[model samples]
Target: MHRLLLPIDALVTLFVLTAVWLGVSSSYDPALSYPVQLGVIVSGGVYLAVAHGLVTWRIAYVFGRLLLLASTAAAAVFILQFAYQDYVEVPAIIERIGSLTTLLPNLNLAWQHPNAEAAFMIGTIPLGVVLIVTSRRWLWRSLWIVCTLVCLYALLLTFSRGAMVGLGATLCIAGLVLSKKLIVRVGAVALLIGGIAAVALTSAGSAWVLSRWDLYRNSLYVAGDYVLTGIGLGDTFPLVYSRYGLLIQVPQLTYPHNLLLSVWMGQGLPGLVIFLLLIITFYLFVRRVLRSQPRRLFHAGWLGVTAILIHGLFDSRQYIEVLWLMGHLFALIGLTAACGRLALWQPEEDVPKVFRRYFPNRLVAATAIAAVIAVILFNQELLAAWHTNQGALAETHAELNPTLRAADREAGFRQAQSLYQQALAINPVWPNANRRMGNLYVKAEDFAQAVPLLEQAYRAEPANIATIKGLALAYMWNGQLEGAAEGFNLLPDPARMAEELLTWGYWRTNEQDQPLLGAYAYETSQLMLPGNVSIPVWQAAADAYRAAGELERARQWYERILAEAPDNTAARQALAELDDA
Candidate 1:
């Protein structure tokens, strides 16, 4: 049972789980909270395994190798993130490393990766690497390659173009590397590449792929601007996407299309240097292993790691459990090699000699484990401070997001106002919070409070249609006719502004171009209430048209009301009264 658990890539699987948890733990969503907790339990198990003299065991070295590989991969990811800071949006490194509460349910869903599902993809990396390493025999190798193909196929489901490209390249490289003969290698590579190209041509050729090229070029140009130093990782992706691909709403967003630039943006030159060095170390280690002992285990691990490195260039699987697991598998391969060289106990030294050979390492591991506990505690304190007032605030604001939409539908002006206040207490300058608050005030006929917040939001974001609309609505509600006109004119389309002005103009000038205003009102009423406009809105609009002397248009609207409710006194009386006028 123990053997079954140990060599079957269980350790790597657990490590990937740890990374996944790290990613998941970053989200504060209630839906992901439970999954985060499970991730925590998994991480704890791995930690426990390390504490229980596992690190010193033969398998312990495997764990260490994986840890080292993971650290290296993380460093690589960080470097790429900084390099393409203009395109890729990286989260806080602390968040990437994860938190204790990462085990909470649905916590990580908030983290939207620009390219792919980071946590899920990262999880696959380690698992893939481990599978490759363990599958060196002919059958196992074939199975492993097939597994990799399947994984990449699954990656397409993520709709991450970068991941797809990277996976394709990695597979191509793998076919070449794993080929037993030159002829087979050449044939396989050609066959696969040609097959893929044919499929791409048949489906859509380069049209789908080329459309996003400008974004990539822009990202490269922006990354080059930073040169030796770049913007922080977390800031880059959002900035790039907002600028280049705002119009294109695809699953693989326009972000730091290149991972190398992302890391450069975050940690700058030193980070880049560290990242490059880590990659070099992996290459050197692989070279050394292949030269000294070209075992199948080593070969598989090396190729797997290479694939991840290739993939990391354009995609970030840092948050994925499988990626981390694969990294650990490579580490395990290296560790097994290292331990074979150390030859600490010769399998004959019993448990005491085993203790003698590995006790010092165990002591250090124990000490480090204790320090980690202290750090966790310290982090918990910091998190508490950050959320001291924030938790209540989040709750307040959280209620508003969904509630405002409902309020808008029902025209529940008062309820909307309360929700906006609740949201403001949580986050005063929250964009939607301010907008919704103003809208609510407009609905309640409270123009005074509505104007200031609406203006604030509009100034901050002039292109925001909702803000402009709210501001104009407030002016209209307050009887500030000219102010309403000015506000309406600010809209990009004059025709829309003219139509709006016609309605309010009718209310102001009782007989000025009444026909035009009435026509506009009738058209608007038709659009707003396809079936009928019996609501107060139609009544007011009709009155505005009548005041503007648009007799025909007013008659049309009044006739509409009477059509809906034949015996409705107001409609009948209004129609008769219009005739008298």
Candidate 2:
């Protein structure tokens, strides 16, 4: 047990340390949020603690039984949820045409995304297999089979192409290895073929498969630039990919979808090596158990690991805590098989002399106390920021809701302001809190207060689109044209910037500020939307030029608009008016 644990502990520690190092080295302060960093550290600690507890108790059999039971219950819940969504929520969107495959929205199931849930379910399938194979009674085997089938059904409903492919591979391997009869192997092949056909025939499924190929290609483009160190954690992908990815719409991909690539991207080469080492070690352990026992549980573990590895090639699952726990659970069971029964408890006196002398219980207690303090220090600010954002959202709802009474709307605004103040009081440096508060002020047309708050937020997360947009609008409203232009120029999407600029120009025109309005329209003219040459844009440009006494430029734009739409009455009238001028 100690031998097995030593390697696992070393690997986990290395992974966690690498993650922390990546975070520290990141150029973007919010590249890895506090919650994610803390979660990773805590997950490693929890894994170690759980493994230690399991080994010390010597209840591997009991634990295995309990795990099977829990997995079965979870599978049941997943199936129920999937069924409800498919039958109940699905019909409401029947009129919408695209892919019938997408009619059932992917089940997130407590995870951040459906892919994560699929990973969890796919990882659990092997445990069910193990239980089924090991069961003595027919009833137990039948029940395990039912549970596994339910889990598989839910996995299918997730519409996760990676999981489906992984499932096919797993089934093939399991059939070849576990089945003595040729009929069983044939049955497995038939299932695989059927699964492939089902996915391929579905409208969305084919598109999903093609998209993954494209994603991989784009990911490679990003990998080329950051080949060695890779982009540091958090949401740097948006920034990096915008600069280096394929010339498509800047995708909102937060992470490299592939598990190995994600590790490489976040932690660089050393981290990737450590991750591969961990996988290799676990594989070897599972192999050893299979060689010795050749039982249902070992085979199931092997297949489960294989399925996750295959799925991970297409999507990220390695970072998810539940999957990590499952992996650790399998490793512990393997260790129990490798090392027979041993002493369940070890006394303090029996502990190594060096450990006792240097790392005593007092030191351990102090470390635990410091950890608690650190977590409190870290999470309080984040929680406060969340509350502040929630308040801002409530204020937005109040403003948008026409049914709300004037008094109620005023109260909502006050509550939002109080929340923002509370958030700032808790943590002045909390990103988004000040930005959101500034946005609230902008909504209220209080440019004076919005400016400084927005400036502060922009300083914290300069590349954040929301911050840039809010700050730009705030600057414009405050009559700071240069600052507004600077902020607007920083926007990556030319189309969006042009639209916003045109909107601002109309607002300025209403305010009788022709010069600023003209400047906005001129800026809009300089911006180009990909694959689109809009006549309305040209008309705005012509109107601005005419207002600014640039008659020749105005005539050219009017001509251009007329060329695009020969029957455009407004353009013809504008052109005639320009001719007279």
Candidate 3:
């Protein structure tokens, strides 16, 4: 049991350290809340603990066999769903092509992302390979073969282009490692080349492949810019990409897509080095174990890890379920290798007498007690913040329902407000609680109450667009025209400014502020809605200028509208009225 726990201890220590560093250094992304991060940590801990227990109790072999059976059954279900969707639900080839434009349908498998499902299936390929190689019975071999084929088919259905590349590369490498004959190696190479060619030659495949290439090139540029201290963990790629990714016309992305680059960009050079070192150490240990033990299961797990790592080269999977699964497999392999080692008791005689005299059990006990107390103190605030976020999400869902009854909607808002207050009572400056509460008030059209809450949120996350928009609107509705305009000016894009102006334009009651708002709106419109302004937008702009007694500017806009639509009665009347003025 001690030998089994050794590898897990090392792994847990490393993971805990990494998690701690990330939590401390990561830039706070509202999308990646503290509750989510805490949940991931808890889940990973549970997985590791369970995996360690299975290995220590010598039940890992049975567990692995059962897992393979379950996975194969799931793969069959996935394949049937795919076939049903493709053949019966939407048979047309053109419709399938259209579906690929969005997300590739998951066939009702609970894995939300197709790429994640594909990665899991691809990782299973090595297990099938190991079973086929090790099983002496014909029935077992045939079952493994069927499982492998099904997984391969399911992988293709996922349409995860990067996973496809990784799978091909992994299979080719496995073939070379497992096959001793030169002829077999040659066949493996040929199959790899042929498969890649087949995929790349297809029109959709070509587009997918080329787009990744563009993204990869852009990622290199990002890596170069932050080659030293990185942008910090959990920092959205858009934070840097907005400035650097324009050349590639890269859409808004959450991550770098490449696992290694993601680490480099998030945690800096030191963190990247540490991550690579961990991988290298694990690989070396696996290789050493395989040499001594020559176990088929160990070989399979090593191959699976290799495949996932290859996949990670082209896609980010570090924070997902794949990583946890990989960690479990690594622990099992490590435990198998360490099983021959003697327990720590056997080494006690070799310890120095002076060191042996001082037992650290008391110190350990005191440390444990302190840690428990700290956690108990911290958990109260964390729970409050988590509940507050949940309430906010509930409110958002209620607000989204256009057909919701007034009573139910009000109840949701009230519940959300209560939750936010609870969170504030625990931690007054809790990150998003104030902002969410403020937005709730804004939705209710209670601008006076919203202004102070929004101001607090704005102070907390000054760069957040939602906070800026909410505060600006709150100010506008509360009759603070100058403050609203100032908040609108904080936006980076002219188009966004124009759009927001249109949203809150009706609130401009101040005569003094009308000409300023009108002039800014019209100027931004020229850049945004070139060639022809929509009638409503033009009329709104004309009305603002007219309210400000700026007939000349209003007349010019009216003339422009008339140019687009010569028969426009409103524009003609407005121009005539301006002329009379």
Which numbered prediction scores highest in lDDT against the true structure? 2
Task: Compose the digit string of candidate 2's lDDT tens values, residues 1-581.
Answer: 35434554677789778778764353233434344555567666655654555553235445555656665566555554453343322233331321333334556555334566577778778777777777789998898788787777667656667877887878887887667899998998888888778767888778777777767765764453344455555555555554334222355566667878877776665677677776765554444344444434445545766887788888874454433443543444343432321222234434344223322346446657986886688777656645664564455435544477899889888887888888788877665578767877887779899999989988877866667777877776676766776777776665567665666566555556564455454444344343457776677767876776777877887888888899999989988876776
The CA root-mean-square deviation of candidate 1, after full C-alpha superposition on the true structure, stands at: 16.3
- Backbone clashes under 3 angstroms, per model: 70, 1, 0
In model 3, which runs have C-alpha deviations exceeding 4 angstroms? 1-12, 24-61, 76-112, 187-202, 210-273, 286-293, 316-551
> Residue by residue across 1-55, what tens digits does model 3's lDDT show?
3432344345544544554555324432434324333443564455455435553
- Residues 417-536, candidate 1: write the lDDT tens digits: 555565566555554556556765664557788888877767755655456666766665554545555665565564554545445545534554444444343344235323544445
What local lDDT score does residue 223 receive in model 2, on the 0 to 100 scale? 52
Taken over the whole model, the C-alpha lDDT of each candidate is 0.46, 0.62, 0.60
Query: What C-alpha lDDT, on a 0 to 100 scale, does residue 89 get in candidate 3?
Result: 25
Q: Give candidate 1's total backbone clashes.
A: 70
Ranking by lDDT, best first?
2, 3, 1
User: All candidates: CA RMSD in angstroms?
Assistant: 16.3, 12.8, 11.8
Ranking by TM-score: 2, 3, 1
Residue 335, candidate 2: Cα error in Å is 6.6
